[model samples]
Target: MDADTPRRHDASPGQVPHDLLATAELVAGGALRSRDRMWRAGVALGRPLAYALPTTGAGSPPMAGAATLLLCFPFDLEEMPAGCGYRKIELAVTFDDESLRALDLQPGAGWAGPDGARVTAFGLGRNRLRWTFEAPRTGGTLSPDGRWAQAVLASPAPLTDVSGRVQVRGVIEHPLLSGTRAEGEVRTRDEVPFSLTRADVWAAAPLAGRTPRPGAWALTGHESIGPPGERLPPGRQHLCLAVDIEKYSTRGNADMIRLQRSLLRVMRAACARAAVDWDACGRQAQGDGYLLVLPPETDDTRAVPHLLDGLAGALAAVNREPHGGTRSPLRTRMRAAFHHGIVHEGDSGYAGSAVVELFRMLDADPLRALLADDQSTDLVVAFSDRTYQDLVPQGYEGLSPVGFKRTDIRVKQFAGVAWIRSHGHAGPPPPDLTAPV
Candidate 1:
């Protein structure tokens, strides 16, 4: 450990912290100075530098003949040359045996320094690399939340020449890989196979059901209550925005997953922009849509319009742009319902009449008819009568009485009146459903 590197006085003599935990603070601080020096030293010595991977593997390194190496240099690609992202840093080496090995250039691995950088490999190449890195055409920069672009070496051929050190420097803006949109969704490149939220990773594995434990049991009125003591308190009044993608079931599983995720991104972004805390919001994922519960203190009257406006902008942008290499024009529309209700906080999720009404409003036939009737409309928003009376009449930034048509909503167990508005098209909703309640 360097002198400046803090020593853990908490650990007894033989107990050193894991290499990763030990250096996490340094890594987070963006201290690449020493990492660069180490890379340069490895280059001068003409030896392969060993970097620890995030996960553990079998003791033996995969054989050179059996496995290909991915040398990732996670750095800003734009700060470098035009072709630098695709440029391969050739390291001269005598392979124990050449069996058609291909190497990839990727963003730097953890603890790797700038300029004089370190390379870390996750696994051998499993598929052919494709050229996906492109600067944003919309004049957007990297995500303000610290998302970075990566330069991947597309199409791996057998490496013939390998020798010496290859230098990589700078950062560049690439097509949105990950970032927060104006709507507040964390946009991750669809090409990335999987993205896990911190909650996803840290979530406790599901048990069979509510685990019964030895505790103080109480009988309430006519039933036995929780062994933990009393039943959990009911969730406070919250603004619930329930959104569902139109024709979500029409697509195949793969496409459905993609579309749903995209919708979620937009929803999250919109909520964020509306001043609703993404992490704090009670999120319950349904198949094609979700139920997002805002805190009691949220200005629902102000928040709804902001969310809708941002949501419209986000959907428009996504719909206008081409995604991946698929020829299928990405098209999606949503039906959303805004309601306020107290939810019964459950171990798995929130419950209450509010949650039920929101879902019912989303699945309303009138909302469906509206989307089916207007080909250009990408989103339709409905406010429960209570919400409309409380917030809609306020003339918030993006809302107005004239903009919405009053409709009687009756779907499943839901019976109520709501005000509906459409985005991406100009016109009143179909007269059949908008008739006098």
Candidate 2:
């Protein structure tokens, strides 16, 4: 055959060359058509039924044949129950004919009948050809249920140049496939307990469609309910107040520090007006008494503008130092689950109290009056770069009395938060003041 032209299978008599007989033998032996026939012929030719000839010689020399025969197989077979008739036979071949020496071979086996009852062979190479056969399906019926057949092919050397065609010519005898569906639902309930003073009943409702806000701080106060000399149920009412400080971190900025102090002063003034004892309000000089719930550390760098603005207004009222412009606007984003609640005992007598009870009260009612003023708010605060440092008092001033005295306080700087502890006593005095100054 010419190097640039394809060899016709039905060439005129006397046109087929003697050397082409080997190629003809490959075709006639089913190497280019049926897999079963090819296996039978290979067995007859001393080649194992499972042995496939390498397209290239042992030393990697290319095969001298016009085309490397890769695969051959009959198309359709009986379908198992619950199985669809999907047949695919692929062959990787290479063409060495004069007209298509560089062409790659790809032949496939497929079925065409509506029920996959008809089989055909097709391939793409120097050109495309389709071969059809009218043979009845002879394989035993596939189980009514679907079954799986898997085969793996491997070669020592990469089968790069081997190319051939697969001709599937048979009828399918099984039915189409089907699948099963599962049916079912689930339900649950969360019961959170809560208690509130008569005045805070309205504030107990959800804010912005969220759960009711928990109290910011809890105060355990003993009030004499009966005669002064009478021992009426211990003559003291233990009041546990919960306070929730929203945007605590945002308010930790320098500006907000001043504002917070001013707010504290205002709260004190309010307590004075209400004839409430500010000392008994559970005020700790060192750290914020309530635990602060913080989000997992994040990479967000946007400072909360509203928090900064609020701090600015608060500082102006306190007449304290204004936050320098060193504040970076980047604020860490906090998820709802990031939370920490702390309890401070102004009297030092409540340190050994149940922490769970305190936390539960806080979780149930996070907005309660800690100061005599009944100024309820969230306990947790978000901090900004410049303000975070200013609000978080450091050293002895930031350490709780119990923490400073017992040396139980721990301080570390990570992701910008300065942490301190109060071993269990009220926090230390403010930095700007001395014992007798």
Candidate 3:
């Protein structure tokens, strides 16, 4: 070959592994597809991650945060991708606010992150609009790495103050798995309360025969209400369980994402095996932690053992396999708190002294110290005196008080007694717990 022949770019410079680019292609046309099949086939990849954020934008009429609610899902293709918003959704929204008159919403989906992305206008009729967005494109919206593809709600039109709550049912279909319609899976849906003030965001309602203006709705905010849902009555007493990933903030976004997925699976699987009806429980997501308000009928006998044992078994199984991500394999370890008390639904979330006490136990100095000192342990639970007395002393089927040790908890304005238990060994309480209180 002539030396002057524009040698392949690979040979032109120091470029290495030039053929690596040969592998990039659209999987759509392939006869076999969807992430679900891969999951069923024993792939260790975690399930999809999604959540809803409700924000009130500032405008002539303060837009209802629900209108500016951002619907997020995930999509992967080449470096750049194109998609239609509604094709991948199968969700039903039930809200109690009667004054929520429909205002114009923006439609038309492209990438929803960065200056390079665009959210065009689309008229909404009967208010059934949500977009499963591009993850990488909208990294700026939710995730830093473009994991949550987002569809911002059209506009807010709350005639009165938010007097009721909104609930989302059904699942967000994975675009790649259009062939397999998985049902009743634990979908990622959370309420993000926003009090930001802006309007001129959502254009006019683009109902029938009307076209929504492109790039008209751009909802923005800084402060947000932590994600939580008070699905049960506050005065009602039930079992409360809360769990947090140890050292969650120390991990990168990718690791955090993987851990969150694993944690959910562990929770759901444990509940199922324990015969706990997860849906019946009032729940909330606390970034790195999760709280559950068990069903009123929950039998402490079965609930305690099942919840703890299931968590341990599931954690062992998942830890054996690497979760979804490019980082090193992540091992699941958490600190859990269990207490039985009356919980109330606050405007932002479930509030009450019970909620506060549960957190105090979970974050108790002894619990944190035990987890930190014992690296081999995967989980440590601090059961309030109420929980310990109800289960362990009553001779429940799976309850064993063998290694549990009494630990005094004094956090903030609360002072109480808690029993600490790790997988098989309960470490000594922190110095503070033993110090003069």
Instruction: Give the candidate number with the greatest TM-score.
Output: 3
CA lDDT, every model vs. true structure: 0.45, 0.24, 0.50
Best by lDDT: 3
Q: Name model 1 segments beyond 4 Å from true.
A: 1-229, 425-437
RMSD of 1: 20.7
Which lDDT value does model 3 have at 13?
21
How accurate locally is residue 256 in candidate 3, as Cα lDDT from 0 to 100? 70
Q: Rank the candidates by lDDT, best first.
A: 3, 1, 2
Task: For model 1, state the Cα shift of residue 429 in Å.
Answer: 26
**Of the candidates numbered 1 and 2, which has the greater lDDT value?**
1
Question: Per-residue lDDT of 47-95 in model 2, one digit per residue for the tens?
Answer: 0011122343332222222122222211112222242222222112222
**Per-residue lDDT of model 3, residues 1-437, tens digit only:** 43211112111121111111011111221233444432210011111221123343322333333453333333222122222121122122223443233343333545354423344333244333343332233222222232332233333453222222111222222324555432222222332121212321221221224343321222222223335663544387888889999888988765676566567666765676567865567767677888888988888787887778777766665565422222245566899988998887554467788889999998889999998888777888898998788788777787788879999999888899999978732222122111110
> What is the Cα-based lDDT of residue 431 in candidate 1?
18
**Model 1 per-residue lDDT tens digits across residues 67-153:** 222222111111222211211121112223234233433432442322333344331332322222212334423221111111211
Better of 2 and 3 by lDDT: 3
Better candidate by lDDT, 1 or 3: 3
- TM-scores, one per candidate: 0.49, 0.19, 0.53
